[model samples]
Target: MMTALLLFWPALAALLVLLVKGQGAKRVAFIAALVEFAIALFAATTFVVAKTAPQFELSVPWVERAGISFSIGMDGISLLMVLLTTFLVPLIVLSSFKHDYKKPNAFYALILFMQTGLIGVFVAQDAFLFYFFWEVALIPVYFISAIWGGARRVAVTFKFFVYTIFGSFFMLAAFIYLYFQTPATGIAPHSSDINAFYQLALDTNTQSWIFWFLFLAFAIKMPVFPFHTWQPDTYTEAPAQATMLLSGIMLKMGIYGVLRWLLPVVPSGASQWLDVVLVLSIIGIIYASVIAIRQRDLKRLIAYSSIAHVGLISAGIFSLTEQGLQGGVIQMLSHGINVVGLFFIIDIIFSRTKTREILSLGGITQTTPALSICFMILMLGSVALPLTNGFVGEFLLLSGVFQYNYVFGAVAGITIILGAVYMLRMFQGVMFGTRSPETEVFADLTFNEKAVLIPLVIMVFWIGLFPSTFLDISEPAVFNLLNIIQKR
Candidate 1:
């Protein structure tokens, strides 16, 4: 029952938000998001970490003849992902209060609608259902970017749409193929249940091809390396709220997909391609970090930095070490929190100074100590400063990768150095030196902005100080997944 509520509540709220008029929609959407977050927190209380199987399970026949079910549930992983979604969303919506976009109702409504798609993807246990929600999640964000984005919104959004859709088709093909491979049962010859796919024992060759099919889909979403061409543009072009949704939550769908579906479902094929994928992930870490250092646009730099952070997460996951997987899991939460805060800070700077160019702004710290302090904390977290969230996850991830291969681990470690370089450079450039003309009268964070950032700042420390709170929740699930891979 709770699973169903978590899945559908955002959608219902979206409809309610649509009914609202004028700026009331912002309040309606925000309250609705808060209610959804409250429900998720309550649900978390009931989640038993000791149980490895999904709790609050709900399965109903969706296409009886075709062996499809409207199935969803929460394990440690799904719950954490849901928590991330619910937690970040209200902040994302609240952050939008500063900007009264045209058709505020529609803007807020789409955000709520996107939340449903995101939640559905996390909780979905059926392959078809996961795919359904995956596509559903994309639609609102696409519209959000295309309709509300910067001048290049059309071209940038279209490229993003094309990339994702192309990837989706590949994923669908992989799912259909996997569905056909499932054991014949009842009226249908195959099933789309995630467990059924997990139980499949495909030959090496078949698994190899299917691996690429699915990897292409997830890689594009994660925008791993060569396939990441569309990301920076989309992130830059989208509105701040839209960018938050994409970076903080949307991109995690791919990472979640890799953990939940790709690695476990195709372990043999994954093993076959392990080195290749790791190399790509490591390259992205270096490539993106280097690019970020040269970037003048604050938003674009953060966008590239996201690619680097995600690269490490991907590497950790594919390494298949206990530490690596756990690190990946915890890092997902940490990255989401830190990145959203960074982007929100960037948005605040852009809103006030009317510019995001590093050269075009400075000395904000002198005028806006609060903004400077918040930005510094979030930036430090991004660079993995000890006692911050980024450090815990990155430490474990690097350890995991090191366990896999010292050379690769060593290469991946450069992210920390480069990360610090770019982040510190960005911070120093924006907050210090002489004030640019645009930032001469920069104001401090407003009440609503403080409300949005304070919680994120708190989380940066919460996860940093005691990662075990989250690591414990995901440990059992990670072990269970690893056991499945080993057995096969």
Candidate 2:
């Protein structure tokens, strides 16, 4: 029941929002998102952290002849991902309050609609069901970016659409092939349940091919190095709210796919390609960091920085250490919080000065002390300051990677230094020095802006001060996943 509500509410709200006129749509959408978040929080209260199997499960035959089921549930991992989605969504919607985009109703409706697909992806327990929601999630964002984004929205969004859809085909192919491999049973002679996939025992050669097919899909979404060509342009070109949805919640879909589907479903294959994937992730971290340092556009720099951050999370997950996986899990939450805050700050800056170019702005702190403080905190979190949220996850991730290989771990550690270099440099350039003409009369954050950032700032400290609150929820599940891999 809870699982179903989490999956359907946003969709229903989206429909309701479509009926609303003018600015009312934003309010309705924001309220709907809040209600959804409350439901998720209430559901969290009923969750059993110690239980490894999915709870609040609901499985129904959706395609009886083909062996598909409309199955959904929450485990520690699915729950965390859902929580992240629900928590960030309202903020994403609320952050849009200041913007008066054309066709306001459709804009808000698409965001709420995207929420449904995102929650569905997080909670889905069936392979085909996961794929269904995975694609469902992409459709709204496609329209959001293409319709409401910057000047190059069409070209940039088309490329993003192509990259994702192209990857989806490979994933579908992989899922279909795996579906056929399942043992005959019931009316369909085979099942698409995730557990069925988990029990598959393909030969090394088969697993190797499956690894690439699946990796290509997940890697492109995570926008892992070499496959990440489409990300910077898309993130920069998308509207602020659209960018938040993509970076904060949508990208996690890829990482979640890797954890839930890729690693466990194809452990031997994952093991086979482990080193190769790690190298690529590490390369992304360094490559993105170097690029970010040279970027003059605040939004673009943060976009590249996101690539670096997720690169570490990807490497940590593939490293297969307890700390690595746990770090990856916690870091997903932290990164989502910090990145959204950073991007929102960027939005605020852009809205005020009509510029995001770092060199074209300066001395914002002189006039906007509150904005400076909030920006600094989010920036510090991004740079992994010791007492901030980013530190906890990076520490555990580095520890996990070190456990896998000291050399790789050492190389990955450079992210901390490089991260600080770029983030601090960005902060210094944007908030200090002589006031640029655009920023000469910069105003402080407005009420709505502070409303959006304060909660994010609070979370940065909460996660930093006591990560165990989240780590405990995911620990059992992480261990369970590792056990599956080890057994394979």
lDDT of 2: 0.94
Worst 10 residues of 1 by lDDT: 181-190
Models 1 onward score TM values of 0.99, 0.99
Q: Residue-wise lDDT of candidate 2 within 423-469, one digit each (tens)?
A: 99999999999998899888899998899999999999999999999
Report the C-alpha lDDT of model 1 over 1-488, residue by residue, as the tens digit.
99999989989999998899999999999999999999999999989999899999999999988999999999999999999999999999999899989998899989999999999999999999999999999999999999999999999999999999999999999999999989976997789999999999999898899899999999999879989999999999999999999999999999999999998898999999999999999999999999999999999999999999999999999999999999999999999999999999999999998899999988899988788888989999999999999999999999999999999999999999999999999999999999889989988999999999999999999999999999999988999999999998
The lDDT of each candidate is 0.94, 0.94
Q: Taking the candidates one at a time, how many backbone clashes does each contain?
A: 0, 0
List clashing residue pairs in candidate 1. none
**lDDT score for residue 270 of model 1:** 93
Off by over 4 Å in 2: none
